[model samples]
Target: MKRSFSILSLLTQGTGLLALALALGGNPPARADENLFGFVRGAETLPKGHYDVYQTVTLRTGKDVGVYRGWDSDTEVEYGFTDKLQGSLSLVNRYIYNRGVEELDDTNHLTFGGFEGTTKYRILSPFKDPFGLAVRLETGWLLHDEVAGLLEHEIYVAPEIIVQKNFLDDTLITELNFGGEWAWGKDPAEQYYKEFSLQGGVGVTYRIAPKWFVGLEGHARGEWPLFNFNLFEHSVVYAGPAIHYATERWWVTLSYNYQIYGHGIDELPRTQTFAEETRHEIRFKVGFNF
Candidate 1:
């Protein structure tokens, strides 16, 4: 199914941001649920009964073709059931505009993409414990392929292990994440297939100023046609820099990633993966705590 959002969503986002601007003078945040990196996740969960609203935008372009551009807008709400457990729900809207792409036909459209549910459990606290550790599970159903922009019926589950460490009296922070993703879906042609992928990332962040952070992150991912790696099809690597700012009521993070290396099914991708990946990606996120 292809879904589309009306003007109400744009109005909602605008109003929410306007509210955030008005509350800039509110007391600083007492919680650590804010995001420090764009692609990497930290091992921090919200305190019990705490709620946070987030808006994330992702841009994927540079497909080595003629003017290919895609954007995803995600709106998410997160709630903490306990100090160690947190859950979130999100909706994704997708827009694509392309012309004269070698692989893709000319198209311009904006549609509702999908929704997802995510749960996280913290086992160690980076602030109190020697190091932080957490487990996160994400389940989602989508109607469109993430990179290809093709219609499909796909349900996926991704489980990840997250670790965090703090140094320099909390001025410097590091996080590592590794995960496996499994999906069973019908492609655009209505053919069923099972896909699996292994992905990992590492990130380092340092406080540059009050409530401002600068970070670097790296990511690697490889996919298989089935559950085993013997059928591996492609892999990609990305490295990037990120900037983040947080306050008592709101936080925003922005990042840019460049495809570093990859391998495709038929050929080795020297600098990037063009078959199923993009050469450049940009992400921006803003969060409000309630």
Candidate 2:
């Protein structure tokens, strides 16, 4: 476990150093307003011909039978294919550790989560229209062994629509997002199941300085069993505060979200305990733009 933590720390530090080096190495294009919220994506796309690279680390913990902890690291490269379109590719790594429960104590595992790709298209720009409008599609394929007994072999699709409105001379911004995800896979018992989830969120941010912003966001999510089509499996809601800092070449964001409520299907047998829901989540992201 210590070795795994060291490796993850080294990877994060190395990526940060590489991003800094790139930011300082050459004369890149002028930086635009960054998509600052780490947890809730905004409706804005990168400028045409520009690129952004980011690294994000997330931590989640819960108290079920005992204590369950999960960590995820995602590295992404995003590019603007046109003024109204953008694409991104990401690599994900995940780790889980559980303690205190006799049947699950000292069970810690680290593995590759998956590879994800995303495309976003802007239909309307707030600068030119009354409100910003956009849509995004994301897909991922799991590539590693299941972590802590939770299944990882699945393919998932997510689609979302984004809406944004700016106020106070563009210093205050608000965004809304609606989305759904579907995942299909077979369990270790060879039982096939499809997981369907609906998600939505709203975020409000205000620029506090030339390069700093503060915000809050609220999110709600619900899961369902697909075979029955109408059976609700679980639901969770989260709210948090977020902060962002940016420069001409680099940017960073940090946020904390606590699950305010949860219901149904939060527990499982000892063998599948890792799939349990968490109480809170924390995220940190850093990016370099060029």
Candidate 3:
């Protein structure tokens, strides 16, 4: 009877160990959700001691009436402090060419855009849990306004929440992101201004081949020029397609987002885009892991 009891206890212990092993080893494919989309992010962070370098370029064009072109470039280095947390710092630069835009003065030059830092923490892994979740925070100081293509001094803080889900054995992935930004700045006239914006985006990707994915993304944004909620300035919506290719050590992605809807108090007749924003945006991104 004692032998029978001992055998039962050993079997129970063996089963428990097996289950623990399965749980610990069931992580998603390497960096599965790490930047599969251009704008909407996923909830996977690098493993401890891993690092990556990224370069991104964005172009904004067509401000309704006059010739307006803006280019933004960013370089970032990211490092994983732990499996759950990662951090990055980015250097930004911008170039703007403006002609007869009523709201903007004529200018054609490249200027420093800003410097920013970001932190992200993952709470769950879609492969292991029901879904993936993460929180992110970004802080920046501006030398060139992003939308207006003008010289300004500004400080901004942005916070975001990201969620991701996978289907069909990771062949398809979906992500949703929600974020808000608060900014304080001084215009060229030396007057102070406070601004706030709300943003949301959704992306869906399907893996057609190994290390290749094609996706579509949609984004919406609304802004309040001052602290008052009644002063709603403008709202715009963008939707486009993205393509990405990845190897073990490197990846590249490109996307084009076009404004499909716009409305504002100070917008053009019939076409309601704000002077600060444009009708089209294109972005290209590349990353290397080490």
Candidate 4:
């Protein structure tokens, strides 16, 4: 177990360095308003009366042979309570149709919901330079019923920082985002089934036009046994390109994600047979605000 934990720590650090290197190697394009933290969009480009709504369909494919799935939708709604302060809520609903599973415990997959709230403050505007910078912090909690039992919840604490710059009449801009999450209660590492995880990610966004944008993001998640097998750990790497579109009060995004899982976690000293697992998934996201 101790050996497993050590390997995961080293791998996570190595992947983080790689992400930094990639970000630096990119072309030196014109700077724009960018947020260096958080996946949730704050004021972005909205006024007081405007709100936004988003929905996404995600397709997940397992590593094993003959494993396929359907579209899983995630929905979110946000409203500008005030200019700098906003309130938002998100929920996920999906259908899982797996082939060849003999009477799996969770059926059809109905009845699931979670809630989160974010407050953003606009620190500064683009001024005459057509560039802006902002700092924001938000707190949220998650509740999952199917995992353990009803009323059993998972806790997530996230603090983020974001920076945005606008260039060439806002037609072209760049964004930088970075943040970390500390999770507890319930299994934070889905594959391990029981463990606490600390994870962080960095992302950059480039706007091609008024309604079109592209992004490159890299994230790392590491988990260690909190209760049993305290020395065991696991790490994962995810990076991909994403697209965004907006129509009045509605927004949508689509992307392909590639994921790599490190070794050590699957090779338990007690368990003789080692299980190797690694794969990719296609993610679709749609959102709206009022």
Top model by lDDT, which number? 1
Model 3, residue 15: what's the lDDT?
96
TM-scores of all predicted structures: 0.87, 0.81, 0.86, 0.62
Ranking of candidates on TM-score, top first: 1, 3, 2, 4
Alpha carbon deviation, residue 100, candidate 3 (Å): 1.8
Best TM-score goes to which candidate? 1
- Encode model 3's per-residue lDDT on 135-176: one tens digit a residue: 999999988787555678888899999899999998999999
- Model 1 clash number: 3
- Give the alpha carbon lDDT tens digit for every residue of 1-290 in model 1: 12336577777899998889768954444574978988899999998999999999999898776887889888999999999999999998889888877667788888767889999999999999999999999999888766556787788999999999999989999999999999888476233377888999999999999999998998889988867778778899999999999888899999998998977877643666777778888999999998
- What is the overall TM-score of model 2 with all chains considered together? 0.81
lDDT of 4 by residue, 165-187 (tens): 65666555455545555555554
Better of 1 and 4 by TM-score: 1
Q: In order, what lDDT does every prediction score?
A: 0.87, 0.79, 0.85, 0.52
Deviation (Å) of 97 in candidate 4:
4.0
- lDDT minimum window of 10 residues, candidate 2: 267-276
User: Which candidate, 1 or 3, has the higher TM-score?
Assistant: 1
Point out where model 2 deviates above 4 Å.
1-33, 101-106, 144-151, 189-192, 265-275
